[model samples]
Target chain A: MAESRRPLPRPTPETQHFWDGTRERELRLQRCDACSQVYFPPRPFCPACASRKVSVFAASGRGTLYSYVINHRAPPGSGFEPPYSIAVVELDEGPRMMTNIVGVPQTPEALQLDMPVEAVYEDFTDQITLPFFRPLEAS
Target chain B: MRPGSVAIVGAAETTELGRIPDQSQLQLHADAALNTLADAGLTPADVDGVATAGESPTGVAHYLGITPTWVDGTAVGGCSFMLHVRHAAAAINEGFCKTVLITHGESGRSRIGRGGFSRPAASLQGQFEAPFGTMGAPSTFTIPVLRYMKKYGVTEEQLAMVAVVQREWAARNPRASYRDPIDVDDVLSSDMIAYPFRKLMCCLVTDGGGALILTSAERARDFPQRPVYVIGTGESVETPMVSQMEDFTTSRAFRVSGRAAFEEAGIAHGDVDHLMIYDAFAHLPLYGLEDLGFVGRGEAADFVEERNTAEGGKLPLNTNGGGLSYMHSGMYGMYALQESVRQLRGTAPAQVKDARISIAHGVGGMFAASGTIVLSNEAR
Candidate 1:
């Protein structure tokens, strides 16, 4: 039963490195060497400029909770429970990522937008660990 | 642009619209494809390319008994079908195939193959929003509409104004399913499906099928119809994840695509005669109006209030009743383009009187991808 839970998107050639980094418990951003723009969707080249000079870089893995929604439906093969916080995290390195705000009470008031959050990796297997986020209290 | 203009010469549908019989998804697709070919005065043998949507094990090309040079089953969102027109046009322009048929069949009314594509959420989207009960298209779109209403200070009356006006337009359209004219009060009072969006604002899913036969403008001369030239098109994607979208009040994708389409067509906004924006919900037109640059930002409600967007107004829109009242075959994008073509032909049941220029706009994937097409009397 545990073996059936597969991530919805099996990363393709363009995004395999990004997913691999996720599994390795490191947040990697595809940074364009030509323009210094970090891309969330790892691509063949820089979207800002048509330059193919782009490389993956490990980010600080700290970010702010940008926005989120709580999904109730049980998607096929997705073992997540209802009422979990799915969100966009604005990374410290400036790239916004689609992720979940985990280990926090799920409510609009509790899950405030722009709340400071940091990434925590949950290793499921040797090749797959999801990067979930938690609220980082402002010091 | 090079001279390879894909003209939609034929269009047909099998809208078991009001009360669709229990036909399989494949049967609906086959019927629509055959009907479209007959309408175009051709047969399945004459077609070389087939583009389709819906969960049918039999691929469209194999079902149609012809081999296509290109097969695009990109299931991005409901509006992905409109995106296919642009893809088909480019393919036709590139001399890949001559006759391209784009089609869609869905038993949404019956929920065939329910949860067919609801696989695991990956690519960080699952990590963030998928767990939080922030689910599905209607609910995802609802939050943004709420934000639009909130940020713009749009009242419920103004939001309902879209439905009142749409009902009016739908009344004239024989193809429209819901003919009962609704007022602002009716829209406001209707059962709230999601906050800010009432049952009236949401599109009624109907079991329907739509088919389009696209051929070069040069090939259009031989057909028994006026050639609606594919002038200019632009499609853009913002984010597949709803939570990642930058703004809820407006669509960034539409803004991007609108500029590109306007530039490609070399036409000004004021020059547009007919507008066919996807009205999956009332707020869609609101978002579309703002991002399409028709009205000032956050003023789409006022734009509708001023009666600038209704039929017989300065800007006549959704002449074939739109998806709100018309049969929505899951993907409303193809329907929008088909209606635009019908308007240009002066043959639509709800024709926009001599529509020389028509804009076919589609909003898809929780406002992720927007595609715009500017079809004129001829390529200017």
Candidate 2:
């Protein structure tokens, strides 16, 4: 069996705008026009208030390392190398997203919880650009 | 909704467990279902309601040649079986069905006629979490423990203790996989799969299944085996993605589900004689302990380290060795419920003497959903 390439995101009608922003190196999020509450993994309606009145806007792309695990075993066909860090970053706008930590050693000593980090985009394909995080000081 | 209205008269696991290559996923369900029916001294024709996960209740009913009046195919995650039990009980009381058969089977290791665990690119997980190289449970389900450790001053040794103590229970069970005794040192020194989770802290991936039969309390006494009354039940969900959990230190779903069960049962924490908190990973029991109000915040680590949940301790937990030392087919909630039934029936390998009440609590996804069931030997 041959090694399979890593999976890429497929944008839906509701989430296409967020993926579109990523291709241009911008972090896009949805906020409710009625409640002014921000959310992620975009949808047409506000999850908080069930209000369909929402708008898309560019985000700061800044966050802090909330939690993560240094994976020692890579799944078959997943392009990740062993000992890579899979982290969840708490965005400044209050929604949290899962991403990878880059530009630093993927070890407990290097990736501290609550450490300030910023988004860096990787263009995997013409249609998909994944956003990873790294120590703010490293950038 | 009322305590003791419904009771479990039949409970059994597959004829064989741990690496069953001969049985496909549906066959495993059939094997367990047949075993359970035999345990209750009934036949497939007697079952009027069907509930299951992994395999559809429709498929189970058709394969077993039963024409069911009511069925539930709830597949939230590992804990789906717990929800099935709750739903089955309510369905029975409402006259929707008489005898309910809930079954679970998964060829997790053999991959025999089993579906792949992939999400569509357009799905929520595929769009956000999976794109970043998230592997299955080991990578994703094990993500929140780091924040939990930092917030509560939990140490790696304490986490290892969960595996160690459960192994003690497994050692006494003849059917447990990898029943040889293991200690905290052995656990800590074991291979690391994910940070904060060593090889022993992770659940074993084996192929097995279990089944249960429930009916109204009035009809339960006619069965051959001791009837375990369904005293209370609860179920809830939080988020599908681990990153979206309200707080990493706790499981909001577990809290909500457990409280509802306890309230419905009208029992205090002290009334529980045995407990089974789904241990898909080591951190789960820690979160379960606090979230279920068995311990205060930041106290579960010390509570387990102090031997409160170990053998001859205040609360006997995971007495069947749990998913860690016991058998963990992808969905482990069935096995958890089985152990609760065994403990309450006084037939468990590591049975607590004179055990009366047992609570089986399970988390479905990565803290995404939860279901809790309280069982007792006495009707009251």
Candidate 3:
């Protein structure tokens, strides 16, 4: 409920496309044209090859919970409820991103490693939509 | 090119360790420098080389009223001082300067005259990681630790023992901020700051600083105190942010720096008499032990849990109580170096009997950077 007080990120020119895609509920990833390597956090060139010939593309928005921590203490008045989880999710394209696990109890029992998760967007502002992760339900 | 060509002639911490709300950050640096200068039987004029981190070396040199022929300000993180020692040794060997002085001071607890770091909103960490409500060191450091716990099956109780053992060492040191005995249960029940990490697992926030003086091995014996020969030194950097570490289970910088130092010193693991690993968190020592090849991968936890690194154990670690029980003034590396010097000089409160060789390894910016120094009481 204390969503408004959470720290918000301001996108730079290098990461504008990724942030813009979040507003449309799309997870954007940078793929290297030379090596076909996909990387996260939206870098201009490929981390593997350092090639500037990279393209931003809509990702599958699906990933697995690689690792996480359940924070019991929140900064005073930060609006983050206690027992919330901060996590690193490994995307299907072979890149990882830091996010929060939502739509489930923020506990070790609920947020197991390697659990399937999908991206969910919360529009904190008209220009910014932070991407979070939620457990994927079996079809 | 010899490893023991340079030696540490003087080492001392701030007059007071735990809390000094009145002293500014620079004054703390000056106090430690003056103490070390007195210990070395030298004055500011004798300090021809200077190095520091968190604060500008120029500022330290100017305030101490000394002009240096050589200066290094390598601020990689908390481990900056370790790198400074390595650089100072190289500088001295190259005849850049004869006597090198390295100082570290931070008013972390008091926040008195400490510099602030602000990144542009578009910066890599600012854009990617900081926006996600990641709290400072406590929260960011947990990223890899959680993975390490799951991958290696490290139990919470095992991690708690790190604090318990270090506290046992702390009980002996009079300058230690926390000398009370603590148990695994005490650490487990302490306030959970971040998941998988309790308050006891984190380092104590205190205001203090330490200084070191290094000169040629030829002039080392001329000094008043027992010179701790700097046999080997290595320094390296990995990533600026913990979230970007190459691996979650191990620190690449630790391996690089430790291996280089071991190779330079030509000493085996069994030869080490005392060890000091920068323990900003309990997990760091675990990584340092394994990554430095002291113990096999995945065996460090059991090694520590079995009381190997505790008092009277096969390998006594953190004899000055370490950052966990001693005083951590932001940059904890300087204090680690000071403890190593103390152990080599046969003057540590929790001295290891007949301890000849001490290795001081430090991590800066989580696992982002590392520096390792090998010291010996006698020059071969």
Clash numbers, per candidate: 20, 0, 0
Report the TM-score of chain B alone for all candidates. Answer: 0.94, 0.99, 0.99
By TM-score: ranked, best first: 2, 3, 1
TM-scores for the candidates: 0.78, 0.98, 0.97
Stretches off by above 4 angstroms in model 1 are A1-139, B1-4, B18-21, B55-58, B113-115, B121-123
Model 2: per-residue lDDT, tens digit, B87-165? 9989999999999999998999998989898788889899899877778899999999999999989999999999999
For model 1 the local lDDT of residue A128 reads 56
TM-score of structure candidate 2: 0.98
Model 2 clashes, total count = 0
> In model 3, which regions exceed 4 Å deviation?
A1-3
> What digit string (tens of lDDT, one per residue) describes model 2 on residues A30-121?
99999999998799999999999999999999999999999999866568888899899999999999999999998899999999999998
What lDDT score is found at residue B214 in candidate 3? 96
lDDT of 3 by residue, A20-121 (tens): 999999999999999999887777999899999999999999989887778887868776878888788888988888889899988788888989999998
Winner by lDDT: 2
Quality class of the docking in candidate 3, CAPRI style = medium
- Extract clashing residue pairs from model 3: none
lDDT of 1 by residue, B1-380 (tens): 33226688888787455446577667677777887888899988888777765643247777778777776675667777677777888888888889988887777777653335463555444544443344566656655554566567888799788878877888887778988888888888887554556778778788778788888887888998777887878889897766657776677899998888888777888888999899888778888878888888888888888888776688888777777887676678877887888888888886676678899999887887888888876643
